[model samples]
Target: DAGITQSPRYKITETGRQVTLMCHQTWSHSYMFWYRQDLGHGLRLIYYSAAADITDKGEVPDGYVVSRSKTENFPLTLESATRSQTSVYFCASSPVAGTEAFFGQGTRLTVV
Candidate 1:
């Protein structure tokens, strides 16, 4: 695909189980981010990677981990998913910061 894509647009898991969300960008953007959006609260950054071998934590990195082994792929994993982690996850990318961003539709995760 020429645009970003996410797998398992919706997910259901039990607490303490591992869940991985996949993201792929055809543009091969240098920067990729994972954010979770809740009903009352706006999107909160979970993790981000500037490029392969360069990853950093964002606003709410707890319970989430991200890796970018390739320029076009960034995957987010929830080690021991929790009920609080249930939310809509969005993957975003940009050639650089403070510029136009492309976002995947979203992955809705439910941890019971």
Candidate 2:
């Protein structure tokens, strides 16, 4: 069973292109999160949604957006992609915060 999945596991784009990454979970987890992995920052939260259409801004929300119209799906959008935004992105879901979060494989994004 595909517990959680992220689409287009790898991507390459220009500095100004807009890119969207998809995440879907089957568990109907109450909390969904988007995080970016970089060498210096490690894994940092980009955005998170507690429930459908109820999302909160994370540490790095700039140039990124997220929407959760359904409990099982959370999509992360880069309105204006940048080189600094180039990193491995991860989607995670959990029943609640401070608990073990189930994660997707990951989507590697590269902005040239």
Candidate 3:
């Protein structure tokens, strides 16, 4: 069974455009989250959803948006990409937080 998956393993974009990152899971986990990992920022949450149709902003949701219409998919969109947003984005799923989490390979986004 596929645990989780992320698209575009790598991406290069300009400083002012829109990009959407895709996430999918087969476990049907009720909790899905989006996070970005940078050299110094470590791992910071962008958004999360406890269940279908229920979403909430996380620690770093300023330039990002997320939607969870189905338990199996959670997609993130950067309304307008920025150089500061250049980082690896990861999608994670878990039954709950602070426990073992399953992560996607990650999408390395570079905005020049």
Candidate 4:
């Protein structure tokens, strides 16, 4: 029963408030990513980490922050929540780039 999991499947926060979506994997995958899923944009990469202490910005990095202190955890934080940031966020981990990845159930965040 070891797999990726996200905390707070759903969350509601006010605009300007800061919110963080946590992701953890028991498999110790080397590649972890944070993506936001919206109506028209589909899945947009927000950030990713190749290894512990190594992170990089992705397609949409503005307004978001991510860090990976451990190989098994990747957390994404919205510095200042906004209505435009309201979307379903997904966390995925892969053994390597360009390979199949395992995803968490996702976190639904509503910024109002």
lDDT of 2 at 26: 95
Highest lDDT, which number?
A: 4
Q: Which ten residues in a row have the lowest lDDT in candidate 4?
A: 94-103
Model 3, 1-112: lDDT tens per residue? 5789999899998878999999999998889999999997789999999899999999989988888888999999998999999999999999875677899999999999
Evaluate model 2: give its lDDT.
Answer: 0.93
lDDT by residue for model 4 over 47-70, one digit each (tens)?
Answer: 999999999999999999988999
Per-candidate clashes, comma-separated: 0, 0, 0, 0
Q: Candidate 2: where are CA atoms >4 Å away?
A: none
Per-model RMSD to reference: 0.7, 0.9, 1.2, 0.7
Give me the overall lDDT of model 4.
Answer: 0.94
- The true-versus-predicted C-alpha distance at residue 67 of model 4, in Å, is 0.8
Off by over 4 Å in 4: none
Q: List the residue pairs that clash in candidate 3.
A: none
Assess the local accuracy of residue 48 in candidate 3 as a C-alpha lDDT between 0 and 100: 92
Winner on TM-score (1 vs 2):
1
State in Å the error of residue 36, model 3. Answer: 0.5
TM-score for candidate 2, residues paired by index: 0.96
How do all models score by TM-score? 0.97, 0.96, 0.94, 0.97
lDDT of 1 by residue, 49-101 (tens): 88888999999998888888899999999999999999999999999877877
Local accuracy by lDDT, each model: 0.92, 0.93, 0.92, 0.94
Clashes of 2: 0
